[model samples]
Target: MGSPGRSHRRLPQAPDRKTSIQEAALLPISRRQALALGGAALLAGSAGDARAASPQGQLTWAVHVSLAPTWFDPAETPGMITPFMLLYALHDAMVKPMPGQTAAPCLADAWKMAPDGLSYEFTVRKDVTFHNGEPVTAEDVKFSFERYRGTSASVMKERVAAVETPDARTVRFVLKKPWPDFLTFYSSATGAGWIVPKKYIQQVGEEGFKKAPIGAGPYKFVSFTPGVELVFEAFEGYWRKLPSVKRLVLKVIPEESTRLAALKRGEVDIAYSIRGELAEELQRTPGFTLKPVVIQGTFWLYFPEQWDPKSPWHDLRVREAAALAMDYKSINEALTLGYSRVANSIIPDSFEFFWKPPPAVYDPRQAKALLAAAGFRNGFDAGDYYCDASYANLAEAVLNNLQEVGIRVKLRPLERAAFFSAYAEKKLKNIIQAASGAFGNAATRLDAFVMKGGTYAYGHYDDLEALFAEQAVELDQKKRTELLHKIQRLVHERVIYAPIWQLAFINGQGKRVRESALGLIEGHAYSAPYEDVTINTG
Candidate 1:
């Protein structure tokens, strides 16, 4: 608690059932452990009507980097929910996307898109209260959207053409055109067109507002240490029951191995999804467990359009050869301990209608033949860029795979911050990069690679501008799928991203880590996880 001022946010709390944690460990008991523990007493027992009678009730979560959201003003970045991630514990989004459930209400009890197709209305839930104890007003709900559009979020402005509040407790959005995918955008992490407190923003300008903001969620932020840590306390009056625990900490530790080691040593209680090569070992450790949950993310490579003219990769044959040469099987087994899957397509299994029904294509010898036929029989040496603390190792595994085909690889690693900034500019000199955590949407995939100015485009697909213009505006799911499927099929055929496995957004934590999922998995838009899970203390 004495680690200096941490950011403030509200978290939800719930009373623990006496046998919840035990019941959760549903595995049949063993004789040796049962006999030895038959006489041993339970460590902490009993729960009250209000809270856990004995709850360390505090949780510490670790991730590879601090929550450095690029844009807090959601309007600035199209579909970005930086504020939501920042205010996750402190506020809730209107609809939450759970593992199996369709989008359900968080702040607003229910919502409907008008028959006209351009207007969307919501019946704001009147039961919620802000951390400040004020009744959540309909005005507040309307204000969150208007406030997000403070001329700062140009991207948001472009996507959300207009907003109108026709009545108290009702907010309607009238778009320039009918968008059936409206729900998809709102549910997206970046699509959280949240209603920020208009009064608070007026009181504290932009910079001041980011330092501390308000939301109606399960936890309240207390303070933040840039690049170090964030501490949160439970919001008892959360619309949902308060979180079972009293406090939570989101600690940033960038070193992948060190983070895993920290979890093993009990230095931190929880680590978010950790997808490095060390996952299997961590799962095997006693009293600690690994839970592999499906994530809406995919990891792959990038090419700088700026440098494409100078490389042989521009030739489709060479590019395909390179893609074929990268031994995903060996890479997954050696670097990821065979815990990961080789991604043949950019669309991951979690995405709707994603058919993972067939065998993966892998042919290093064929890749060699293709490379030899491409006029450079000797193959070529290249450098790949990696920013993750542990990604260099994955890069090395890739290097080995490529090396077998007479292609030499040099691993280039940059600091996470530098790597990200460089990537944003699309100025990488070489071909090695890893991209993941794309919230599952056809548009998300299209935006990443096919958009005129996309993050993954880096310069590989030059003619994609036309495709993106149409894909971006096509609102019909079936029509959009045809386009998305064609574009992604092109992604594989073109081998623009000599794809690495689609990695889950993973982190590592210790003995007390419980939840397999976290609030941040959805990207920068939504904030509804603090009260979702019930954790009993270690």
Candidate 2:
């Protein structure tokens, strides 16, 4: 398989073909369409003799962000794509994302929902053992869920009434009410699905565990140098096939040019988040491969104090004017090379429940009129526009567009850890550029970013909050979908956020790498099923 052009290709099947057809159906194309699009060829290439005969080698992956120990701890996880880069390697979840499917059973062998939809029972796999040689038990599952302190903890606390371990192998979760998306929430796509060794954590304590963590993932933790690199070795006792690559090194190379140089010089096997002209250049290069995957995220602008009447953003006219000021077409062409789609709503257009609002009008005249009506004829300074280094280009583009409309914004870029820490602590005071590619349906995205008291939420509306709460417990799918549509409409009508475009991630892979699967879903950015990846030695 080579780098795809304008179109997307179906992901190859995982080494373990345990995924269900229902899960595979959730992808953009049907299974038949997938097979027609060279899926069989890809599958055969992944499991062929070449991969089997390849000798185990060390695979060095270069990432743009600096990783920290906090990303490895399941309890303190921030539930974003970046953290999962470490989480997927250091820890194993009860349910994990299948190669081309929604989710597949991992530590948990089977699960069933109650007739009333208020409880879920999972059959824990008895054969599974953590890296420390401790058997994974139902008690451990219960403890992991209870000890979660991440952003998703609010959803868990509100929905999960109690956890019961009837026996060593059976674990049940009693819900506060009927929730249709309960399974998706607990899937590997989110933080709630991660399972940790309870006994080990209690013995070492949370802080100590961060320093040296133990989990049931395919790779065992070797060592970590903060802001530098993380090393891991294949776990011989892993439940699945041992990783084909014996050693894995994740190096923190924040500079894109340096990472590209490392890839060309064979210092790194994989380089992540390659964009703009560099991505196009890498695609044409002989030895390098450019892999582009559509993520379930958007590059958009957020107003932190939009709800405060004292702030200029409190006026709906001003927000609408700001939205109109954005030149999405130019932004998409410049930033994404015309690969990304302009977003109409928070939910991507590809999703079934997506509300197709009209494309944003780029009417500078109307925007100026609206601004003048809102008492800012010569648009006021909108404070600083905060974003991580990775999104500096997009932020700069947004800044220029706002400047055209007379809204002055100072660009402020921070490192990955600092950016997220500030965002979580609600320290961002101005228009901020943010992205979220989390898996799950529209409701999951809404709950995570827009709902009242959400992790990244800066504004709240009581009516929308009540509707979200109602939709959570509504058993009927039709009624729940209707409520979700209403919420999306309200958000767009009120200009809650200035939706820009749905982003596609670009990655560069070297010739030495083979049999690698970069997940089938949108949120699988920077995460891969490493055990199945084979390093070519020829």
Candidate 3:
């Protein structure tokens, strides 16, 4: 598969498979296509193989962002991958993207889609048990799916006709129509398929369950202090294998300086999102390793006010000015030391049916001319620009460029959680620097960020919406690709978003950490497959 950052290159697709849902006939475990669909898990060793060391010591992490309680609950996952950082540690999904495969079988050892594509079946693993000693049955899978109230929950529920549990191990989902993205959406793209204890949730209630969550993952929840830290202990009964480390601790360190300070003091084994000079320092320091993980998150400047006829952004020239004003190359070099790939489209090149737009031309004179033509000869106040506080530097950089082109705006940095909440509710106006790191291809990206009623979309174009609808049910692979490509091209031509770049998340680890698990999973910014992470006991 080609990197999504690579322009004009067609991403490789799995052999003998079509992107259309109507033609997608998935088989059970052991088949090549089934294996392809179920991305291969990042297993440390074969379950039967003897390990050299028993689980020991504690592995602590200094995370770059605040740990939101919403992340602990798979039921409320947004249309992003942030929650999965915690979910991978505390819970197990039916099928999930692991190191190499996009939809690896986890709890459900095998899954198959019916020939007609109206139904899908999953064969639950018989050996798995929740942290509470209760068996993970097919009922749990059905319960979890039905209870999901996450980002894409409504669309999923509307399409699914019924969920059936024929036995303790077999769970079937009958859809109202043939949805080609069933596996992609349910398994990897959304948390709809991440299983939870059926009886436990009912017994404890939603609030209580969140207070003390339990799952069939490698780690069992020990404690959680809001805005501080989350602690977990190894779950011996975890079906995959015993975790390498006995204890895991995730500490929230919102400040980059403080995170690096913690890492320098050996207070944390791993630190995430270290960038710029701090990254250079980490690379220079002995006994420390700095890694740059190229993630799928492509940042972009969104003009929510563009849809409003009364706003200056309603004029195409003004939008184009904003796009042309950005100095992408300099921004990349300054922030990531040129590690981040300058993005040309909202859709990453790695995605299926991706359409690469022409390279972004940064011409301040052209931008000024466009703004002047839009009747803003002396510049205009563009209201508040909302962004995650963690990336305030990025927002400032973008603001500086826009200001140079007469599009003045004030920076409004919110905490990561609040920023997302505000964006989703459409409370913030003007420019929004947004990014989506969720799994899936071009179609999923379009559905979430471009289509009408998308979780993050404030408005939609009628023609684009129609094209999206037309492609949703199109069974022909070539036709689907063409339709998707057209939608992307239209978005680019209209200057809906000023595409930034695919992020190169610079992270670091100490000598005590044997396997940080960083960069092991492609497109995942954080260290993952918690059970595979190990620390030196000696």
Candidate 4:
């Protein structure tokens, strides 16, 4: 009946023995249990919260983590912070952003397109070297892509045919079609993470590659303690100058309170992703550092096309009604600690050309009316899949709001891994929410969200699939802009998915920790370049 807050625990689970990426309860629980798992938010409704430093030479960096990385292979999982580290360090790409936010220049020094717009050529930097000290050749670029083609995770394979290395320093990508953001999607901040050392990767299988990734990054692997720690020392021979900080250490601590407590006690250098409730407390405890960079990202809603027929959401009206009935204003204010702004498109406003925010019209009566029109005047029951404790709090508020609208909705809270898998398989009830994008440009953001094989978006919608393909390689600005707008509108009309907000987390950085491997970028996590980062023990 009332909103509540929880602490240090997952929301209660259903008695049934069922688990999936996004697990549903064998049966929904009473309201009281929901609050417990959301911590403060589940209990009340709103909630809370990387990497190591360099080791080589003289500096040692220490970064605190709240959880073990879900995965370490960037080529495979974009969501894993461990793999993100590899993306910048061991591999090089066609394009990367110049540090201090200048032009794009990561791996490829320069590139050009054919007159027909179908083929794009990138010239690799002459001096770059991989972690194993192999001269980066054009074939390695081709190898990286050839590997990408075998998987469903990447969209690049569909449009690109092959890589041709005319010489040691030149790698040219021949695209099946001309794409405006194709270069950016793969090389820019939005696309291809660095290439892995090919021969070594083949030598060691997927599992070995994850453990000891040898990248040309500023830092190199030192030691890993599984769920507890992973350390890397500086690579002075990095293409860039020696990093100011040296060794970087990643410390894993899954509980939020323990992490915040570690920061206050000066035991951990950073409580990386801060939970919302402990934020005020952490800030109150002096010597804590706050770096509030505007992240280019958004929270995404996942609406499955088909749900169980007997569920309340079996009707489209119920689905649309829940969307309209959700009160984001209250949830944002109460749950996010006022750190985020409402997002319009999957792209963050930080981008150069984010589309205009669509008119936000919130009407619970209309939501109910829609349900009534769809034949549920008396209301029905369903579930909301919460990916985390913090979101569970926000979801509970949404569930609370839906209750007000006469729709009896239950909050189904899950651990992050299972939650993601459930949504990916489209097995959850027709709706769920997740953080989405912050690509540097309109093209990159839209492609990541609507692109055929994007991590966040479901690729089933044919019109969306067609629009994304055309928008990517389309050379004309006028036509590209029009297509982007059409795609956004089309997604809105379908109402299967929508944008919530671009968010920044309140983080706890240690007083003793100095920067080594912690390179901040557009979004959260270790997805940015890890060079020039150093950790100091002195």
The prediction achieving the highest TM-score against the true structure is 3
Give the lowest summed-lDDT range of ten residues in model 1: 1-10
lDDT of 3 by residue, 1-538 (tens): 1111111211122322234121223222212234344233233123445544667899899988888888888998887778988999999998777776666667876666676778888888767899999999999999999999888787789889999999999998998998777777887778899999989999999999999999888899999998899999999888777788999999999999899989989999999988888888888999899888888888999999889999998999999999999999999888887899886788877777889889888899999998888899999999899998888988999999999999999999999988888888888788999888887778888888888888888889999999988887776778888999999999999988889888998888987999998877778878888888988655
In model 2, what is the error at residue 50, expressed in angstroms? 17
RMSD of each: 10.9, 6.4, 5.7, 15.8
Residue by residue across 392-457, what tens digits does model 2's lDDT show?
888888888888888899999998778888988899988888877666667777877899778888
lDDT of 1 at 532: 48
* Per-model lDDT: 0.55, 0.75, 0.82, 0.55
Ranking by TM-score: 3, 2, 4, 1
- What is the Å distance of residue 478 in model 4 from its true position? 1.3
Model 3: residues with Cα > 4 Å off, grouped in runs: 1-45, 48-53
Worst 10 residues of 4 by lDDT: 40-49
**Model 2 segments beyond 4 Å from truth?**
1-55, 350-352, 519-523
Q: Which ten residues in a row have the lowest lDDT in candidate 3?
A: 1-10
Candidate 1 Cα errors over 4 Å, as ranges: 1-56, 69-87, 134-156, 273-277, 306-308, 353-360, 381-384, 406-409, 459-479, 504-528
Query: lDDT, candidate 4, residue 59?
Result: 25
Give the per-residue lDDT digits (tens) of candidate 4, residues 1-538.
Answer: 0111111122222222123111222112212222211222211111010233333444222333322333444455443223344445544455544333312334554455565566666666567787677877777777766665212335667667877888876666677776555554565443243566778888997678777777666667777786577776667666545544565566767666777777777666666556466776766777666644345556655555433456555566776777777777766666556777776556666554456667555689899899889777877655555554445655666667778777775567765556655655556664575654323466555554555565545545687778867776665667777887787676666555555666664566666656623335545444245654544457
How many pairs in model 1 have backbone atoms within 3 A of each other, for residues 3 or more apart or on separate chains, i.e. clashes? 53
Tell how far residue 286 is off in model 4, in angstroms.
Answer: 2.5
Flag clash pairs in model 3. 4-349, 4-350, 21-180, 38-103, 39-101, 39-103, 39-104
